[model samples]
Target: MERIILHCDLNSFYASVELLSHPDLRQTPVAVCGDPTSRHGIILAKNEPAKRFGVQTAETIWQAKKKCPDLVLLPPHHHLYREYSRKVNDIYGQYTDLVEPFGIDESWLDVTGTLHLFGGDARALADTLRRRMRQELGLTLSVGVSFNKVFAKLGSDYKKPDATTVISPENWREIVWPLPVGDLLYVGGAARKLLGQYGVDTIGQLAACKPDMLEQLMGKMGLQLHSYANGLDADPVRSRFEKEPVKSVGNGTTFPQNLTTRDQVRQGIAMLADSVASRLRHLGLYAGGLQVTVRDPQFRDRSRQTRLSAPTHLIREVTETAMDLTEQIWKPPSPIRALTVTAIHLMEAEDTYEQVDLFGGSAATRQRSEKLEAAMDRIRGKYGSSAIAYGAAAPEKEEDPLP
Candidate 1:
């Protein structure tokens, strides 16, 4: 039997969530943006009205304001957004057990087994889902229904705000083929440019290209794109419980001001390493390697990685290694703008045991550190994040804080 997949994408998620409180700004241009006074100023999401004026995500607030002068900027309520995401996914649980979230705002649901319980029609089910979301959550979604995940995602993108698009085996070629090759799954800018160079501008042209010929031109990705274009995608929508294992845990931040001193750089690394280690501990994972990335004032990023003697999820270990790695690549007073610490080469803590070093003292120190950090985690968990902090990792107070 052919699978039934539905991709539900919440329209302008951040902006839409903001509008729930300020409905008066619905018809006007609105955007959710970060504080410009801090270096973190950027448009996170824009509403349809703002988008109509060519406002885009990730662009600076200054650029967005220049395009849409009347754009009403609202600060993000991340906790509220997470609450809504949980509620939305709870509603999806009613339809099927096979629901995979693409992000906080979007999910792909496989309803092949339970479609008849609601209605046999995929389009009707999609419309009903959208209506329920709007009426219950004051949010809207665009849904795509198809036999496969790729086409289902494309169907969601085929329309806007609150609508459903269906791509069937019979009508897929008619509805999807003439569209640009970029419309196909995994066909990003690089792939699109390569396809264009070979006169494969449309999905039809891409589908018509011989797989072997495409492989010769673009390697493995070419073959994958050709398969997606030809509607040969058979990838299953994984159940929520079947999420992929963690490859790496990382945290990064752009500082409020350029970090010109070694102390400031150390503080940044310590802060990021603390976050990465905390997350790793929570997940019961340990890192066998550490990766650090340093971004300069020019926004050029340089990164380096080093393997650990053994896996660890301790903040002291992560921070010390990250600081050493950062020092190796960066000669301080270079004006660091941002820093990231990533825990890589992960392994389940339960599956591995800490080994005693050949020298002996290092193993006892690690054991002591683990017990101390575990207690610290419990303290922070109960008292809140600000209740505890490492002296070196503490952020310096800003002279004039953004309001």
Candidate 2:
């Protein structure tokens, strides 16, 4: 039997959630944006009206305002969004156990087995889910019903606001082939450009191309795209309980002022590495490698990666390695707008074994450091994140303290 997959995508999620509180602005062009004063002045999400005004997400606040002079800007309420996402997924749980969340705003559900209980009609069930979301959560979503995850996601994007689009075996080729090749799953900018060079601009064109040719051009991703374009995707929707292991853990921040000295850069890297290490410990994972990215004033980014001598979740090791990686790509006295530290090549803590050198006594030092960090974690959990921090990782205090 063919799988019955549904991809549900919340429409203008952040903006819609914000409008729930400000019902008066529902008709106005509104956008949820990051704080401009903190240098995060970008459009995170925009409502339908804002879309009509040519405002787009990830564009600067000023650029959005320039397109729509009367665009209403609201600060993001991340906690509230998370709460709603949980509630929305709870509703999905009522329908099927095979619910795989793509992100906070999107999820894929496999209703192949349970469709009979919900009237055995995929399109009807999709419509019902959409209606329930709108009535219960005061939010709208678009659902795509198809035989595979990729096509179902594309189906959801075919329509907008609160609508259901079904692409079945009988009509999938007719419905999907006419769309842009980029509309297919995993066909990113680089792949799209490569396909364009070969005159494969439409889904039909991509499907018509030989898989071997695509593999020759794009390696493995080429073959994957070919399968997706031909509606041969067999990927299953995993249940929420089947958590996928994280590939990497990272954190980044844009500094209020450009960091121009070695001390300032070290401080920034330490702060970011502290967060990365803390998260690694929480997940009971350790990093086998680390990567650091530095962005200058021109928005140009330089990145470097290095393999650790041994897997570790220690803050000192992560910070030191990240600083070394940053120094390789960056020089002191050069202004740095932002910094990111990523813990890569992760392994479960239990699966990792520490290697000790005969002369260094490093194993004993690491054991002590682990205990201290664990104690710190307990203290912060009992009190608050601000209750305790590593001395070197803590943010610098202002010269004139605020009252």
The whole-model lDDT of each prediction reads 0.88, 0.90
Steric clash pairs (candidate 2): none
- How displaced is residue 268 in candidate 1, in Å? 0.8
For candidate 1, give the lDDT of residue 75.
94
Candidate 1 overall Cα lDDT vs. reference?
0.88
List runs of model 1 lying over 4 Å from the truth.
171-247, 289-309, 320-334, 350-365, 378-403
Instruction: Give model 1 RMSD, 1 decimal.
Output: 5.4
lDDT of model 1 at position 295: 85
Model 2 C-alpha lDDT per residue in residues 2-73, reported as the tens digit of each score: 899999999999999999999999999999999989988889999999999999998889999999999999
Q: Quote model 2's TM-score.
A: 0.83
lDDT of 1 at 146: 96
Candidate 1 clash figure, as a count:
0
At residue 251, what lDDT does model 1 achieve? 98
